[model samples]
Target: MDAVVKALSARVDAHDAGEKIVHRPTREEAEAAVRTLIAYAGDDPDREGLVETPKRVAKAYRELFGGYEEDAGTVLAKVFEDVEGYGDMVLVRDIPFHSHCEHHMVPFHGSAHIAYFPSKGVVGLSKLARVVDVFARRLQTQETMTQQIADAVEDALQPRGIAVLIEAEHMCMSMRGVRKSGSSTVTTVFTGIFREEPAEQARFFTQVRLGK
Candidate 1:
């Protein structure tokens, strides 16, 4: 296993993308590494209690972070031409998500609120969730993730305004660092009219905060 790690590490080093290497080990390699971790932790991975744990974890990852395999534009590409020129803020709230924090590779569970006012056309509500998924799938901080959601919506639709709010609990903080069980992180991003017009932003915020 050490030899395998050495070979893989060499490959990542050779193809290093930047300061924080974005190496994606193959599924087989990832599962093998998980098996090694189970063994290293003094667990008999082949035992009935743990027999399929590695495979399960790997498969779970494929689902949890599947955004990498999808394109955000494809999801939002369909736009409505005839809103009859009815322009108003389109708000989508409580879009559920679970992402891994790049810092600790631990879960950060949350719901997102996305809002945008179309200038010429509008996208469906579900596309808002797809926009969130793209940034969430990769290593992220809440601040950057929030901005990404807003920016993508604006870039896609040339909207009059864009707002994104994220509220999450970081397992890295709750389960390990300081271990504060109830601590929650909230972040927001606003642009265009949402930034210039206070009332518009407030309207979006008020709606997302309801039933929170």
Candidate 2:
């Protein structure tokens, strides 16, 4: 069992290492790109009012895309086996998050609900929220973000089942094409028992919708 765990851990480490950017642009370059976009928008980049806008935008990009520097596996590394033999679904709901739409590079704000059935080990509850944030801080589609959260939890805990649901309002939809204001998008992903058992899936959804 130790060998198996070590092997899995090594694989996860390698995967995370591979995901890192090798030749990323410098801060100055990023600021330059932002200036270019400002100019393209018919603004004077050198004007007094806009002189610092590119630097500010570049700084904001660092925060918005910070997930690229995080590893979900690392956040989920610590697990507790002292659950007192509690073996049932553990759900965390209403975890608010902000992400950029990969398609339009606009903002999307949402809440995520995650649930998992542990076998012998359980992770810290806050780690689940951290997992959500790690994925949420990246450029993503609602559908892809949901699945990524589910997959990250499953990979870390080896849970018997996992389910993830995300509901979000996309600025691209409301401010651009279609202009469907107040409309939200939802995406769900189920794995293991959540995928195999209809009753379990229903229970997960019920728990997720309990107060919302």
Candidate 3:
């Protein structure tokens, strides 16, 4: 099941990899594609209000999918060695983010809680939030994004342990399929000590849900 899921995600990530590698489409081409979609959806692309819609959507796509242009490692590259030898678990919770559903191209909005045991030094608190945003700004499945965020942090910091929990409401389920509104999905990834120690996992869960 895990292998199948990974395969599916890889396909989604490489939707147009061939074209992208050869020659990415220009802004005009993107706008034209949007216009084609508008027409296919039974809308008049030439209509005054909709005439400019394609352009707007194309522009929005750049901002919405900008994560593809960023590297999480770069964001986490700088570390602070001045922790005064303070070695402990650091937790950041209630990080709000929104991402497009890779399957339906809709949206899923959520919060991510991250915890890590610093092996050597510590990173800026804001860097963690930035990490969440970096992944959130891309087309994703909650499960895949959860793993990606955990992997990115683990690779960059080489922490003793890392835990990532994400809770989200996928619009694909509510807006289209089952139509079950107000339903949220949660996904988590634990590495190293967090994976080995049940107590640490329990502590993470407790802290994440402490007030909420």
Candidate 4:
């Protein structure tokens, strides 16, 4: 079966009496898994330098992967009631995020550039960063993460256009695959006006990229 199908099936199986599925990983399970990773890395977890590492890593990941415990829809729930009819392009740039690549379970550290044109009501400025965080906390691919973040924001705000860009360095490719330490990966997602209008997308890209 496809990944989506499997995920859906798992969700269905995990439903409660109200038919709602809770998807967040437990703190205990995550900490135990950190121990597993520590062992897999061929290290002694009891050593002084590494003794607190597992617990620290788990605690750190609780914040990093906090998205699994949050509803992105709810995070963006509060839209601006009054913007004084402010309807220009709303762009949030260089929103820092980190996630583990699902394939290798290695860290991918990056920043995202997000932009959207409001249709009617717009979201708060911080909501943009929260939306980005919701996706970046999971084990993911840069490509899918980019698309999912863009889709979630578009769905929540119903924007005229939405665009996202992620620039990350994958430890999997660097620490394992090709072993190139300095190379970074970039991914982008564009929808609505950004998808239909070439100039809009280019302008968005030029704005974020040139500034960097």
lDDT of 3 by residue, 1-212 (tens): 44532332321243343634323466778899999999999999999999999889978987897777667899999988889888789999999999999888999998999999998678899999998988898888898899889988988889999999999999998999899999999999999999999999999999999949
TM-score of 4: 0.79
What are the clashing pairs of model 3?
none
Model 2, runs deviating above 4 Å: 1-22
Whichever of 2 and 4 has more TM-score, that candidate is 2
lDDT (Cα atoms) of all candidates against the true structure: 0.78, 0.85, 0.86, 0.79
Q: What local lDDT does model 3 show for residue 48?
A: 94
Residue pairs that clash (backbone atoms under 3 angstroms), model 2: none
- Cα lDDT over the full model 2: 0.85
The C-alpha stretches of model 1 lying farther than 4 A from their native spots are 1-23
Candidate 1 TM-score versus the reference: 0.84
Off by over 4 Å in 4: 1-40, 46-54
Error at 139, model 3, angstroms: 1.5
Q: Give the TM-score of candidate 2.
A: 0.89
Clashing pairs in 4: none
